[model samples]
Target: MDQIIELFRHLINPAWIIDNGGLYLLIAIIFAETGLFVGFFLPGDSLLFLAGFYGNELSASFHDAPFVVLMLLIAVAGVLGNMVGFWFGRKSGPMLYNRKDTFFFKKKHLHQAHDFYEKYGGGAIFFARFLPIIRTFAPIVAGIVGMDRKKFMFFNLIGSFAWVFSMMLAGYFLGKKFPGLKDHLELIVIGLVVVTTFPVLFKLLFGKAKGPIKTEAAKATEESESK
Candidate 1:
């Protein structure tokens, strides 16, 4: 477990991101993670936070990197990613269910995301942005259900702004203040991931059936009218 966590520690390191592909790569990953099914394994929250945490270093190295502007662009990337994912779901949702679950992928995640959309409708698109894997699947589920594109885009725009800016900005500022947190990043990342995922988990395990409910009073009224 320790080894695994340690490995992940490096995976989301801001310096690694900068040294690797910098702004473009970051945006691409953010898009791919949310838009592409194959991107399910990428650590999004940690990466965004890391960008904020290491904003100074990143700017210094990149020389002319616009910190806030980059974040906004990242937000755009996230929104666009979901939009693409929505289209993918519309086109390929059938094949998706056919593929079996693996260590890297789980049909359960899609089902859970589907439930979120069913229960909350357009709102789930906004909500799912905060959750990791669910964020990836949320837009897709919206597509599968054939949600209006306008509604999806509206919710997607709002959710993307909320998710990307809020998270990345928080990371950037928090990182500036608590610079030491990065040393214990595995713990921080785990805690963040757990806290965010808890709501999804709670809803899935304990949530009541939200499928169409016929009220007893309505049923009685209909029967009386029929009689």
Candidate 2:
């Protein structure tokens, strides 16, 4: 039991992940986080950033190239991950809508993903890659809505490349310029989490839903105006 607990603790630690699993584990986590519904809790933004921060070390197996191989592999993993999620949603179809929530599933997230898809059309898949929880579900929702396979792949490829390179390169270049930046991994991770998550939380908590619901005050005002 203690060993299992300890392992999970280490799993969330980006430094430990790089030190232990290096390139392979990083790719697996990226795939799971984007592809698996239960994997929504896994670190995404921070992991990518840290992978970039340790690009040379992670990519040490590949000489002659610095961060190129690292970035490309991660990008492929991300793309493939979304494809899997899309396939799952496509297979599951509307049945997913009727399914009850469980420990690993939440109806609200599915609903939010649906709303996001409705509002953004096909771009939600691309945009959701930056948002944590939604990133996991956006591709699934794309499949559920029966988004064209070619169109989904279009956004999936571009979004995967964009997300991977942006996050990784940011860390890669910054770490290259400032060696001491690694000393503050906690701070960097926190900042990245806030930057990526705040928008999603904001949208969930405050973004307009499918239709406006009238407040008591709104109802009173409408009644008075009608009178």
Candidate 3:
């Protein structure tokens, strides 16, 4: 935990990156976090926030490297990451569906994502990007479902930009105003995750109740047609 927190702090410090290796590390982390399924556990939101927070720090310290540039780089990384993830999904679609057990595949997770996609369509792609664990699986499931490529791309771009921009901006403003936020950032992040996930939870519960109702209605329609 301490190591992770330190890493976050380092990323936000600016000098840690610019003086050390530069934007390459930032770009690689962003790409891996979004594009690779194994990267679902990576700190996407926090990393963006830290990037922004560090931007503030760097601007004050070095008086160079504007925040807008940092935002642009992160945004581009996120967009490209989603594109890579989409292509990965498309390539692995058959293997994902046909084989239940693969080297790193979990059928239950795949089914859950598929169900969410079915209920929400492309909107799920955008919405899921905000919801931690689900975000990683959403795109892959969309590929498996063979969602329209153009439609998926539109939603993917929107979600990528929105997620990266909102978190980074929040980090910049919040970190500047309340230095204490830097202390308890993890808890705040968890709270954000919970809040974002509420709608999905509600939909899952309500959907169960409505399922039988829809089934009965369908049966009634069939009987009426027979008559």
Candidate 4:
């Protein structure tokens, strides 16, 4: 936990990256987080927030690049990562379903992705990008289900840009308004997680209540027609 937090601090610290190192690291992290299934555990949202928070510091220290440029680069990295993930999922689509005993590819993950895809449809591609566990599995599920390539790309791009921009901008603005915010960054991060996860919780608890009646009514109509 300590190491992770420190790493997060370092990545966002403008002083840590004088030149190419910062850019490369940021891009690599973005790609891994979105493209690799195992990378779901990474601190994507928090990292973006921190990046925004430190944007000013970086801008002052680095003359060759502005903070906006860095943010744009990060945003582009996130978008490309999703595209790569989608393609990877598509490429491994068949093996993901058929393989049973692989270390990296678990059946349960695939099933969960399937359920999310079923429950939310294409919207899941966008919405899932906010949630932790779900976000990681969404692209893989999209690929496995043979979701339309153009449609997935459209939603994926929109979701990635939205998420990256919001978090980064929030960090930057908040840091500017309240310099002390850096002290309580963890709390802010928690708040973000809560806000993002609430929708998924709402859907799970109430989605059924909204549909069972209509389902039963349809079933009754079909039975009456048969009789």
Model with the higher lDDT, candidate 1 or 3: 1
lDDT of each: 0.79, 0.82, 0.68, 0.70
lDDT of 3 at 122: 92
lDDT of 4 by residue, 1-227 (tens): 68866775665444564343655666678777776777765667776777788777656554658777877777788777777777777777656555664544555555555677778889888887777656777887677556788999888888888888888898899899998988776688778667766765665555443211112334577899999
lDDT of 1: 0.79
Please tell me which predicted candidate would have the highest TM-score against the true structure: 2
Whole-structure CA lDDT of model 2: 0.82
For each candidate in turn, the TM-score is 0.80, 0.83, 0.70, 0.73
TM-score of 3: 0.70
- For candidate 4, the clash count comes to 0
Q: Per-residue lDDT tens digits of candidate 2, residues 19-74?
A: 78678898898999898898887778888888788878777744535678889988
Show where candidate 1 strays beyond 4 Å: 1-7, 201-227
Q: Please identify model 4 stretches exceeding 4 Å from their true place.
A: 1-20, 60-64, 97-106, 190-227
RMSD of each: 6.0, 7.7, 7.1, 7.2
Q: Residue 146's C-alpha lDDT in candidate 2? A: 76
lDDT of 3 by residue, 1-227 (tens): 67766775675454576675555677777777666676665656656766666566644443566877767777788777777777877777656556655433555555566677777989988887777546777877776556788998899888888988898888788888888877776677667556766665665455443221122334577899999
Candidate 4 TM-score, true structure as reference: 0.73
The window of 10 residues in a row where model 3 has the poorest summed lDDT is 208-217
Q: Name the 10 consecutive residues with the lowest summed lDDT in model 4.
A: 208-217
